[model samples]
Target: MNHEDAEMELTADSIITQRVIARPRPHRPVQAGGKVGAVPDAPLFLHLDAVTTILDSLAREEPVEAGGLLVGHSCTDSSGPYLLITQAIPATLARGERLCLTFTHEAWNQMLDRKQKEYSEELIVGWYHTHPGLGVFLSGRDLFIHQHFFTDAMQVALVIDPADFTWGLFYWQNDELVAANGYYIYGRSDQTYQALAELLTEYGVSWGIQTEEVDYNA
Candidate 1:
């Protein structure tokens, strides 16, 4: 089978369940230059539970980098297509260092096996990795991985700097990956997002910044 066909087969076999949560509206104001607003076609919605799980795993990794695959359900609404991340599966078998992480073939197979056996209802929506001291930006290797593995337009890349307590999401637009200006954090209460914002701000990493365009060619 071809690449697209292979992806479809993989997804069909792994994704066995779909959960639809309440659609979350953007709470933040739009930034100037139209760089930081919800995309009409595909907006990313991150679940608070997923964020907490990822943060916990990052904490466990400490100074070293950690990586994981995002598993969730993709849904659409009147606004457009949106992905709701419900789970974060840590790559425990990954080879990690202070500056880099490589997900081994064994890890990939194991994750796929678990997805098929346990999380048959969830799909691999994207990926996330800690940057440690580095800021929230995708490196050349990251771009390559996104292009090859996470080729879906709705797929996103999340970069978090545990040292700085900063994070950003990268999405595909106009055939290029660009930093998302805004995203929704849905949970039982708005206070969840408020507390997270406050914590990031206390760490000197404000989340309210304009979406900066990225140049993968650089």
Candidate 2:
């Protein structure tokens, strides 16, 4: 059946599912980077501690692997190498089920409904899911679903590999998946720092942000 028919079916059901109506409200001004201010790329900065905390909480040996939507505003100007708006932690869910084609339609609708009630029409920044064992990257099917739903937009795909306490974020560009260079956000120790540094050097900009030591083992 088509998406329209699927919606009709869902509306008739009795389950209490959140509806994807619209973002509840416009994001209050934030200070990140993205084209919202004409910068070539959106500046994204994620707190490593925040990421670790979220992953830890979601993987506490509970059966319902945690998942949720990211909420934030767009940014334009910044002193650093990248621009970023900001995001807030609103609500979270213990994903009732794993993401797959079978559940994609329902999940999308539910997510949209939640957005409508919470953030108003803002786009999905990314999604987070706990990998009980699945590791930190999109499965082939997940990639296909992402392309189907988020074509031509800069949406983030975040996966948390709980066993190793590591995470992965994928940035989409022109239908091809590319590694999001984290040097601008995480500094030198980040795996992608050197790659981003090279890009900066080619652009005649200095990648002189003082590199901080990251004790991944900490």
Candidate 3:
């Protein structure tokens, strides 16, 4: 049976589950990068905690592909609109292979349930999957999944290569899905800064944290 037959799921949850319905409501506005005014070219932002969660989930699966959902909100400030991904909830029930991932009905339901219970305040921004050693690019199937399931124009797909520690974001550009230029990982400057430093020590991750450090402050 096709997932199109599934009962109407939660609004935001349905989209991730391939049962598109409605877009998430406007979440509170936030300030990220430092610039002000109409800076329309803002980049995607990933929360420090979210990045670690995704890395841990994908890494634990090793050579096989692993997938999950990203939860966050879309907000616009002095610099136009941007996406902020703050959580990565793994799809433990999904089928994964060396270069493929299938979001089974059970898998989507579990992820949707978890997001409702745990991250009630956030929106389902997109989904993330690993390519193991295949590198960071979406295949035809990947694009199909994003287009048919994640319908909202802003919803994106994140692809990662665990073997190389490389990743990229795939978003809707006009009528096409394209790789984003770059993204930012953010957190509370001091404690978050220190914790991130320790968590990503081997990767040479560093940030100058003073009272607060948002690349574009609004």
Candidate 4:
């Protein structure tokens, strides 16, 4: 909302997201706070498809910073609000160096166009960026980008270290960024996560799945 952040704007595009949210059940809420919506340690449901895309992008642009938007639905339930990441679209036109990644207007516009044409109903729940060898944690510039473009309280910031293939998710907690200790990976019953499983184990990151449906009214 500042003059310097005016050029790149999410503008009043759309934030009414539940209309297309993915409802994966047998739910166990990953509550970060006592609130009823997204908070620190809030559950994040990531789809295999999205994870695959993220892995591929990170591999292709290794040793340099790269990034893109996280496409999905932001929904709240009996547990609270969780992000169901359904897709990962890289910013092919983005410019970057070892320590910096800039989401150019062209890159940003490209993502918006794809989201509208392909995943028209889904919201941009958050964003993910690679740190190459630098490791996970947002820099001042990264925070600025997230604060300006991904303004919603439910929105998240994911940092990935392609060097070690380690990653982390951060969300707002009383206007401060808080890291999640674990998350959930939801996908079709047939999908395999052998590769991701190894990485999660290596990093000591916990994950889960809710195969059964939840009965909220029960």
Query: Lowest lDDT 10-mer window, candidate 3?
Result: 25-34
Q: State the local distance difference test value for candidate 1.
A: 0.65
Residue-level lDDT tens digits of model 3 in 94-144: 778766887777887898899889988777888999888888899887877
Q: TM-score for all predictions? A: 0.71, 0.51, 0.75, 0.75
The positional error of residue 161 in candidate 4, measured at the CA in angstroms, is 0.2
Q: Is candidate 1 or candidate 3 better by lDDT?
A: 3
Q: 32-76, model 4: which lDDT tens digit per residue?
A: 112233233456777757777887776663477888889887765
Model 4 per-residue lDDT at 54: 82
Model 1 over residues 1-218: C-alpha lDDT tens digits? 02353344445334333445455443342121123433323366676567777876765635877887888777765555577777788877776777777777666666677666766677788889988898888988788778877877667888888775767888889889998765555444445445545543443544443343222112
Off by over 4 Å in 2: 1-42, 47-53, 56-60, 63-65, 78-109, 183-218
- Model 1, which residues run further than 4 Å from truth? 1-42, 189-206, 209-218
Error of 1 at 16 (Å): 14
Candidate that beats the other on TM-score, 2 or 4, i.e. the better one: 4
So what's the TM-score on candidate 3? Answer: 0.75
Best by lDDT: 4
Q: For model 3, what is the alpha-carbon lDDT of residue 11?
A: 53
Q: Candidate 1 or 2, higher lDDT?
A: 1
How should the candidates be ordered by lDDT, best one leading? 4, 3, 1, 2
